[model samples]
Target: MIGDRLKMLRKEKGLTMKEIGEIIGVSDAAWTKYEKNRAEPSIESLIKIADYFQVSLDFLLGRTNIREPQFVEEANIQSEFLKEFEWSKIGDPSQMYFLVENLSTSIRKYNEHKVTELELQLLLKTISDVVLYFNTLAELKEKYKSITKEVLTEHRKTLSQIIEDLNNILEEAYKDILDGKK
Candidate 1:
């Protein structure tokens, strides 16, 4: 099941086992063994693989088919929100504009497809939460802009940590797509 999911996820990302191996600092043959279920990764290696693939360890271990632990639509919204927020942090005005446009389009598509009210509520709530969080970050950025260089450096470090967290979330979303949950 693990190998099957790994292979499925690799293809879904339009990546090959070799590409994944490179990301995890493993050889293609070693990755092939992973996909073939001929060898299991060590626990640490498994975590690295999960981190590289953006999937939960549970999913990697075949504990659940639901790689994202959230509804499919909500997962997509979260993924898109994270992507937009990350881009915005990098000072990309176009990315911010596209993020809003994409959210609008997503809502319209959901309505056109007759998505359930509950699902719509969940997606909207998720988006709202993300927006509020970004707003808080924006407020902090404004407040910190005039701080001393040392403080600014620390703030930058915090932002980097935030980006790392977002990357992990994105990896999990990628895993979701691989598991056919998105």
Candidate 2:
């Protein structure tokens, strides 16, 4: 399963197994073993392979077909809102189809934004930072699922605050526009 998926992804990306092996600092024979299911790489090596292929470890291990988990589902909804706003900006009836085609390309990208290790690390670090910042919040500690949950919850709260602030700013800007205040 792993080998077949890797081959399919490599072919889809117009890459050869040798090229992938070289990128991950493995010999062609070793790569062949991996591709043929004769050998399995270590966790670290598997991570490297997944990174080189721009896929996820779950995919490399045959645990999942998806390259990335749903980290950007909310972002996708936001993109839809932006696309609608873009359509409203383009008033010409003849331009509507063209705008839709352009929007489709953008939506495809938005939906395919895979969460890489670097992104995951950054997210974890941000969460850690938040937890460190609010270490004294005793009640918050009990609400957490784990020590990591404290961090994650803090991160989520911070993000929610930022989003709320942004919405407030946008509302104020819209009010100004309505009042002809530029």
Candidate 3:
């Protein structure tokens, strides 16, 4: 997926592999490997590639179809959170977009070198897992809607703890990345 997008972007820019290699300080052969999907760029290189192509990591990896590097689509996050909500209409799009825009912008800033590459990847994975968990929880809730109140409350508590744990992980990472407090 990344190789395909990289190839397309290179072609669109009329850049030869050798040229891009020079621009990125890699061998032409290495660029070929990336385009062929035979190898992956290190995160730093991936960030450069994403920057050069004016796209997102999510887009290069085909995690999303939107090609422009905008705020990670709130629709993606909202849909994941509400996919199984029988009462999906209860979701407010404006609120969801506001949340996602801030989260995604922080990530984009991280990618721009506000944080180290490893930390940026950590942020990406953390947020991706969060979205995944939200989607899965929605499914589980929809599936077991008939459960008793006690069971539902237990589920809510368990999920709350999981979310708290996830947030803690992210918060610590931010401290290390932004505050240099590892």
lDDT agreement with native, every candidate = 0.71, 0.65, 0.76
Residue-by-residue lDDT tens digits, candidate 3, 39-132: 9998989888888788888888889877776655665655677454435666565666577678678777776877555655555666676677
Best by TM-score: 3
TM-score of model number 3: 0.44
Which sequence of candidate numbers ranks them by lDDT, best first?
Answer: 3, 1, 2
- Please give the lDDT score for candidate 3: 0.76
Candidate 3 least-lDDT 10 residues: 82-91
lDDT of 2 by residue, 1-182 (tens): 88777678768888777887787788878878877888887788887877776776776777656676342344456568667866788665446556556545644544576433343344345545555546645556666656676667766877775565556545544665878888
RMSD of each: 17.7, 15.7, 11.8
Better of 2 and 3 by lDDT: 3
